[model samples]
Target chain A: MDEPEVEAMDEPEVEAMDEPEVEAPGAPGAPGAPGRGVRERRLHPVTPLRRAWAPVAVGAGWAVHDPDGAYRQVTDLALWTLLLAGGGLVVAAALYGFLSWWFTHFAVTDTELRIRTGLLFRRTAHIRLDRLQAVDVNQPLLARVAGVAKLKMDVIGTDSKDELAYLSEKDAAALRAELLARAAGFAPETAQDVGEAPVANLVHVPPRQLAVSLLLTGSTWVLLVAALAVPPVLWLTTHSPGLVIGTGLPLLGAAGASSVGKFVKEYDWRVGESPDGLRLDHGLLDKEHETVPPGRVQTVRIVEPLLWRRRGWVRVELDVAGSSNSVLVPVAPRELAVEVIARILPGVTVPEAEALSRPPERSKWCVPVWWRGHGLAVTDAVFATRHGLLGRTLALVPHAKVQSVRLTQGPWERRNGVADVHVETGANTTVAARLRDAAEAELLLQAQADRSRTGRRTARPDRWMAQ
Target chain B: MTQQPGDRYGTEGSAAAADAPPGETASPEPVWRSLPRSMLTLRRLLLVVWMVPLAVAAGLLLGLLAGPAWAAFAALPLALLLWGWPLLGRNWRSWRYAERADDLLIQRGVLWREETIVPYGRMQLVEVESGPLQRKFGLASLQLHTAAAATDATIPGLDPREAERLRDRLTELGEARSAGL
Candidate 1:
């Protein structure tokens, strides 16, 4: 498999790029070749191995069920059943896979990527180039072995995700690069320039740091401390070894396993600067490469656990348009988290006291749980909400992304002369530093609501070229 | 109507007092429009007509299968008719919607009050639908779907003509506001 050396693209140009011209299948001049006059006509084919294996694997499972003689099945009879049933299933699956592969066709046009599949009930899904959000290339163990990869495109304003499964590894990479380049509105010659764009490695979570971060995050440390305190207390009170072992061992085991799970899931976490927005690549078994375009992120949360607060470590998480929650920085120093926030969202950052805006001190008494942990800072482009005692969170939501603003006063909050202001974005909503002064919350709600409307009205299409 | 002494805002069981501060609560009491008064009667009748047969069949099946001990569930229909009648009326009475310049507020619930404000600009799709029963009564529901899944708001039991007007107005506003995106 060959990796295509392609450059990053400009955001606005990506949006401005019109629907590309569809090439006839088998044209000589392919997308990769700049000077060739022949239109690229070859539609990449998908590997049929996945579909071939599906039914065979199910049949094999059935054949293997109750293999032990204790289950009253003769070994010879079972083997015969396995051979007949598994063989039949394999043949059936192979035919199905071949038919599917024969019928499925994918084409990358100037403006859109079209994928047509289904032997009888034909379905064709087209993904517009300008609306392309991310191009993910997936290679499972089998696909990698077969030298094939799957290309998935996430487009804006559509539910039908476009997938071109089982392309040759080289072709997949080329297609991904080509699509990204096209989205960025790059001509063939200029596309090479994007490849040279400096990729700033913001922070790479090391094994040691990841372990420390996991330990300090959420209830892992608390559970450990409690586990330590529990045996002593249980031993003194119950004087029963059975109960102690029954409860203590499982708790410790569960906690240890969970810590490892979290570490493994986020193994080799890396954050880097891409052409459009920021790219996050992580995971151990199934590697995930996510490209979060600018303005796609509706809400950004910076969390600092109780222990991590002292160490000045925080986790930066983002909620994009389609996805629920994604971690920008799983765990990093506060400075790095803040730096990432400022970089990703230029106009919005952790409010540092200076000439422009000071942290809201008037609403300090509203948050009774932990006043010090709660703060609200508003800027022209975004509003930042800071809250949490155990795990401190700093949520930065752009005014343009805000769908609505709500000022809620419950019986308890009203009694305390405090209220909560909620700012809702596309997918997620962030409360204004928890409970704030009722009067101030109301004012903030109105101001933020107006800001949201104004921001949407005046927001630029793309900030890349504008900046 | 003067508000109850214990209330902060004009909530359930609390009379709507004339005077209130600007920032203390939402402004101007949001000239609220309640659901059709007949919706309560329609809902109550539907509940009784639907539940009586269902409850009797379930009770009979249980009596035949696992003895009469389980047949006690049949009392559910009678209980529903007795309490559900008033509960439906209260719920129908509580359902109120107010349209502001920028946002639409829908308030419902008797004990646990819930107020949802769906900004007109944020609305992606507006649908006016009527079920068979509702259509028979010339009533329709106006559903507003926003980007946020949780923000999907529905106003039920509006006149069909009114629903159509609201839908057109909302769709127009949504398209106008979303043009910038």
Candidate 2:
């Protein structure tokens, strides 16, 4: 572990030394060394692919103007006529791409990250440095080939609001690190030169596992099977194979397409650790790069499908502040998932599997199916609720993240002397410990209420800049 | 909104409100205050004066267009209005709010009861608003906004002066005890 940590720290510094940086005077990091205006400096130029593809797209559009065959028209066209029209269209598109690339620029001020873009309707958006949440660097398949990346910055109270696209990969990585460090309140001079550090890889999924997981992770294949079955069933009754094939084949194709899409979106999934934050990269065509700070994660869930239960494989999902819900570890052995959880949440102790037994025997009447699986474990820092027999799910929510706790008893539950306790964390996640003894529910509610009080008292303030 | 910034309703007001039946503990719990009585009368008038007449006119128009039998539709609104008159009073009676040391408590509902406790420290903003009907009745509402999007706890049917005072008190306490996540 120490070796990995050291290697991770060295990776970025080594990479930064290789890249040549255009030093702008009076940059945000180099405070007081001011004479020149850093704000006027533009970002790295966008890749020429934008200009290269514009003409090809326009020409393709012209060629495919008619859905039916228009090859006769193409062949009959004069060579000079084709050159004049195609050349004009290509030049026009290339000019537009060039102008767009030239006009867009971003600047870093002490207080804010200013982005100026748009051609006709010029827009200048500034995000306060104090409110900066995370800086993501993404490289699509096309941009990867061109060695360019896009940087997306999320602010505390805003959504995906600002981005600098088509930057050299080195610049993108440097900017991402600098912004993140600045957000964390590290001084400008020391933190600014974080360009070269490479993230240390913690988990890498092999191709076989990725494929198997993709196939079993979602229920899209069920749709494919259902669609295929529909045609055969219809054939027995209507005997109109034509109509059945027409509708079912399209449905089958759509299901297949969606499954393939999910595979593409999650291809080459990787998780790594950097000095600034945890880095996650995925997607084959349109990539997504996300940085989750140490304290930004609110809740984590460990899910084990029925098929995976026998193998002791669990999926670790996390909720971060600025990005969508993501799986930190798609499918890992239970011990590995727990180890990763311990790493992510340092103080929270997850008990061994043997200790996480079923709820009290008195509440057996409330739970009929696989009653042995229901359980709840509470620690000073976190609480875990385990339920679901077929597809078991163990949800862990830090005490500080819990907004409220509810204890509910329906008519049947009241009769059986059982109640359910639900803990909510903002909008994204909730953990419910179901079918517990009514007395236990009351105790749990009170304990959780106390936990929330202590958690709030000790928790870090939401705005670090305010401190 | 003109607000008098002070603890104007001192111990005397809380003591008076705390005069509840024995067996319930005091001191730890703040005395709950009910909405102004005028609010109930205003609601009854709005239903009887505005809603019922509109329904009756619609019923009459339907009768003219369709048949005399359709005019009987007017009775449905009349019956509903009569049934809802006491419900409105009961709802007003059920609405109560208490200003606690650490949090504000709101309790409402006749059947499915709900009690919400909004921590003063968690408050992001405090707003006082009134519509035409509420203004006509000299009543306003105090809304407490927090980071949680679902928390819409607004204490309605307060006197405009009282509403402003409560808003100021909440704002002061919110700033003084600022613990946020």
Candidate 3:
């Protein structure tokens, strides 16, 4: 057997068999076929969708959007009551149809995974087994209640629109395992041991921390709750219970929703090695777990938001090649960042132990080797220099990994003699880090970009002292 | 109207247009060849200006029939607003993919006219696509997916028949490159 090429794992993206990338002299006939190496391309006759409530669900949803108007036309109480019952049935039937279609419409063949959809006129798309890169399983609110889940397979040919379904958790898991095995660079491994709750507890948060986390966010919901603040203040002065309750009710509801969301969204957030690759699972309404390999990672960015900075925390994101552009692990206690670098890189040189023992500068542009008691020797960071409260931000795109660099100076930035540099890295993972440099940082950026460990020592700059 | 950048030279890719460095070719396919005349849809320019306003006018006529003066009046501005999007599409670009011996060259970008060279050795996949319009025009665009993080070089625009021939060459080159790696 050919010795495996990539270290740790041999990761090759397996996009589903999309429209055949027919490359022969003619569009038909395989260049080499009648054998195993030649993948067979077949459009399966779609399995009849159990559509057996999608229309009902869609109709019910439409009715829900305009509730009273639906029955308001019926002045007769008895007639209105009958109409309401029929409406409810329609709604239930639609939900049932949606569930059935979502669950059973997907099929996994030996060489391809096929999804046949569209209500009136069916459309069938087959993604080749070898083309698949990764599979991401998401559980919406309905999925949890019904013990169903949605699985999305990332394949090379994008002609395949996203395939969504509401499959039984057991079936979804089995399908996921099976597809992962067939996908190139993926082999069936023991599934992750996610608990019943499979949620993160946000253990470090203190009591009354809602004031710190939620209120501080000033999210739209918080603003909605705050909008009622004035009326309550007036009512409290007048001592009118009706006015107070009316305004207070929404505030209570908003606060409850925000707190619960904050607590639930970050629950059981785990990022670690999976059999095929890295799996990150988080969120509530829709629980998402994504698997990606290092080869597919185009850019890796480590950021410290102001609040997280105050807590001495950081967030890591990967511009994944297979999935959506951004994959964020929202909370990390600095060490994990280093562990990530050490465990998941090619040639990373950890800054000297003594180098990390230095003090942090007040300016946000630079990350300190040490902040408070914490050590910071990260090669990648997006912090203060590009941070903003409401308006614009200046990101610090590191020089080493930039595929191509775009430097822009607006009239205002030009006036100030400042320029924003966007360093695009990797096609899929366009992780760009920008810094505020008038002219001095150019040498540093260029130096980092050209710094390659594998290159000959003779290729080094004339100023090379490390050798 | 939004005051967009009038024009600038530094932002243009005039300098990056120089021929690639020596010994860079990694595949055996030729990058440049003739293509069909039907690649660009001049008719799209008409729809780009016409369709949206027609729909808005139709909606406005209905509103006027329903007796809403304000809604009828809203049609003029709304139709203009709807039609404006496609007209201001200064950034939309066209591309061409050429398969040459040892490399796949992509010519793209509107004002900048940037051409990228992806030696077959560096490319991992060759993707070809033809949207509805491209199909009508008998043209296809090919994107070259590479393992490199910074940029996945792409070459698009080919006559349908030429696209198929080049696609085979690119695939062969990509396989050979991976094998060598």
Q: Write the per-residue lDDT of candidate 2 for residues A202-277, one digit (tens) a residue.
A: 7765556666765775467777887878888888889997989887988888787667776676677777876556
- Higher-DockQ candidate of 1 and 2: 1
lDDT of 1 at A363: 43
Off by more than 4 A, model 3: A1-68, A76-105, A109-111, A129-133, A156-161, A184-259, A284-286, A322-327, A344-404, A407-420, A425-467, B1-181
Model 1 in CAPRI terms: which quality? incorrect
Q: Highest DockQ: which candidate?
A: 1
Off by over 4 Å in 1: A1-46, A63-65, A69-74, A78-89, A141-148, A156-162, A185-198, A218-257, A352-375, A407-417, A428-433, A462-467, B1-36, B40-102, B107-115, B179-181
For model 2 the local lDDT of residue A160 reads: 45
lDDT of 1 by residue, A1-467 (tens): 00111113322222222335534443332232322232332334445666787886774576587456424654446787868865887788888987777666665555567666676676766666655556566666667667777767765454433567768877776677666665665664454334423457877999789888787666776667767878878999999999888878877876776687678768898888866557776766555556665556778888777777777888888877654237788888888888888888766657642322222454454554476566666666677777665676778888787876666666555666666667777754554545667666655655565566656655545323222
Better of 1 and 3 by TM-score: 1
Tell me each candidate's TM-score.
0.71, 0.76, 0.51
- What value does DockQ give for candidate 3? 0.07
How well is each residue in B1-181 modelled by candidate 3, as lDDT tens digits? 1111232112222222222344433432334543344433433444545765665776677677866654556465556645554543432344455554444545444433333445554455667888886777777876665554445454345676776777787787666534211
Ranking by TM-score: 2, 1, 3
* Better-scoring candidate (lDDT), 1 or 2: 2
Ranking by lDDT: 2, 1, 3
Could you give me the TM-score of model 3 versus the true structure? 0.51
Model 1, position B117, has a per-residue lDDT of 67
